[model samples]
Structure formats: C-alpha cells, structure tokens
Target: MEQLANVKAYLCAVFGAVVGGIVNLMGGWSEDLTTLLLFMGVDFILGLLIAALWKKSNKSDTGALSSYSAWRGLCRKGVSLLVILIAYRLDVTLGVEYIRSAVIFAFIANEGISILENLGIMGVKYPTALKKALDILTSKAENSESVK
Candidate 1:
C-alpha cells in the first residue's frame, strides 16, 4: 500500500511536470507563462476552496464571475503586467535578466502563498508545523533577497 501510494504521488508529480514543461515550451518559457500559470493555479485553488466552504451561501456569480472578484482579478493582472514591464525595462537598460526574473519570482511566490492560504481557509487543514516552516522559509528568502 505504501509503495502504491508513493507510485501514485510520483506519477502525479511527473505528469504535472510534463504538462508544465509543455506549457513553457509552447509559451516560449517566458515570464508571461510563469506569471499566468501562477495566477491560474491560485484562481483554481481559490474557486475550489470557496465551493467547499460556502456550499450553501448562494455564491452569487457576480463578485467572483463578474463584479468585485473580476475587478480585483483585472487589477492584479494590471499590477503584474506593470511589474513585469518595469523589470523588463530595467533589465534591458541594465542588461540583467537575472534581476528581472527575481522580481517576477518574488511576485509570483507572494501571490501563490496568498492563494494557498485562502484555500486553507476553506476547510483545508494545513499542518501548523508546515505552515510555520513555510512562514520561516518565506521570511528568510525575502530577507536574504532584499538584503542583497
């Protein structure tokens, strides 16, 4: 049973990697796909969490599908695009894609964590130890990067 579970986990991870690889291949492995994938991943998780937690709350399609959520989504997209633009231009002027990629990765990680937390709020139990570890990891990473 343990072996079977391990195999299943491995297969899932492999499959996800393959799909992500193809997406990167087709999308030219640019920052665009990375950011877009991160957004979509978070969006799907958020939707799932909302569905799970508010099954009876008459989830009006307005905010999420058309109004507030939609607006917020657009704004996030704009902000992401602006950040990417700034990073790209800075890289072009300074000749350093590394800096550009770092900036984008920071934004992506921040957004990803928030999405995961939102999902957890919807009844998904994140182990306290795991959460604390991630918090420490994130803090260290941010601090290290900012200090340099």
Candidate 2:
C-alpha cells in the first residue's frame, strides 16, 4: 500500500512537471506542483461527472449531450478555463504577472476547498488555518486585475 502511494505520488510529479513545462512554453510560471495536481484531479473528476451525467443512452447515440445536465458540466469547465486564460492573457498584455498569479491562486484555493470536502467525506478532519489561508489567497486573486 505504501508503495502504491509512492508510485501515485511519483506519477503526479511527472504529470505536473510535464504540465509545468507546457505552462512555461506558454510563458506561464511553473506553479507549485501541489496546485497543479489539485487542478488536474479536480478537472478530471469534473470531466468524469460530466461524462456520466451526459452519458449517451447507448453506444449508438453519438450526438452532443441532449440533456441540460451535460451542458452544465461543459459550462463549468469552460468557464473555469476561460477565466484562467483571460487572466493570463491580461497579464501578458498589461506587462504584469498579477493575473497569472491570480489564476493560479484561485485554482489552488478551489483545489484546496475540494480537498477539504473530500477529506470530510472520508471522515477526516482538516486544519482550519489552511482553509483560511486558501480563502484569503482566492479572494486576493479574484481582484487581481484591479491590483494591476
């Protein structure tokens, strides 16, 4: 079990490194690995939920999601990434890195919130200070554009 955990951690590191490289190529900062992993995990689970909720009735049906449930899922991811990209773009245009940092901070906060929720669901307790810190960072990020 310990070995499995180690393997998972290693995989996450590799994945984050690859993503970090991509972000770097795009001129974005190589964010903290923990944040990247959290975003990937959340994005993946959200994608899975979207698929499940909008799942085709059978293997034959191959059109877009017929139900609003599916649309909602698509919208969620779309909005989240759009916000991130817009922030990053603004950062590049205005010659300040605040927007990019904001986007990263927001994602990190979101992932941290999800982590707390998951831990609670598993009957585990989390430290309040951590959540509080994340909340502060998220709030700051939400107003990042204003700062710069």
Candidate 3:
C-alpha cells in the first residue's frame, strides 16, 4: 500500500510538471485551444482510418496509410502548433492579444472542416450548407494567402 501510494504521487508530480510546462510554453491554455487540439487529433485519426482501413476513392495517396504519410501528418500538426506559438509571441511583442485568438480560430475552423471531410469520406452525409461554408472559408483563406 505504501509503495503504491509513492508510485501514484510520483506519477502525479510528473503529470503536473508536464502540463505546467506546456501551459507556460504556450503562453497560457484555454478551453478553445483544448477543443482545437481534440479536433486536430480526431482529424488525424480519421485520416489514418480513411487511408488504411476504409475503401474510399483514391482522392490522393494521403488517403492510404503509409509511414511516410504518418510522418508528414506529425509534421503538419507540429507546424500548426508552431504557428500558434508564433502568434502568441507576436501578441506579446505587439502588446495586443488578438493574434493568438485569431490564429486559434483559424486553426479550429480548418480542423472542423477536415473532421467533416473525414466523416464524409466515411460515408456520412453532411448538410450541403456545411460544405459550402467550408468552401467559402477555404477560398477566403487562399485569397488572403495570395495577397500576402
């Protein structure tokens, strides 16, 4: 019983430290960001399923699970987080906090669209308006990128 208690305490300490480290490194964490992370995870998992397990049309090789693709997914997710970090730093430097919120909102929208697409590939019929809205948002993003 004493050994078990010691093990639990040690695990709790490690978990607390890791969580604290992430919160500090991210310049603070919020429920919105948490939801975005969850959505991103779901998107990645569904993508893997669509590629490796689902008999879906070959929209691209990304629909098939390969180690190369897995690594690519990891890199993409990492870059997403890095973008958020950069946004937070920008907010700090500019003395304005809106950049982080904007970045998080953009990422959440993108993740939501990816999740919906993944569900569609899995044979779920989503509302037509949802796709249209996503298309509009995507095009707007593209336009903004082109302007930059």
Give per-model CA RMSD: 10.0, 9.4, 3.9
Superposed model 3: Cα runs more than 4 Å off: 1-12, 55-63, 128-148
Candidate 3 TM-score, true structure as reference = 0.73
Ranking, TM-score, top scorer first = 3, 1, 2
Q: How close is candidate 1 to the true structure, as a TM-score?
A: 0.53
lDDT of 2 by residue, 1-148 (tens): 9999999999999999987766654456555434655565664464444345544222114522345654564576456655666767777898886666767677777777765664554456778898888788778877874666
Clashing pairs in 3: 51-63
Query: How high is the CA lDDT of each candidate model?
Result: 0.59, 0.63, 0.77
Q: Score every model by TM-score.
A: 0.53, 0.52, 0.73
lDDT tens digits, residues 30-144, model 3?
Answer: 9868977998899888887888898452444545567777677779988998888888888899897667766776777798898897898898888989777767755655554
lDDT order of candidates, top first: 3, 2, 1
Steric clash pairs (candidate 1): none
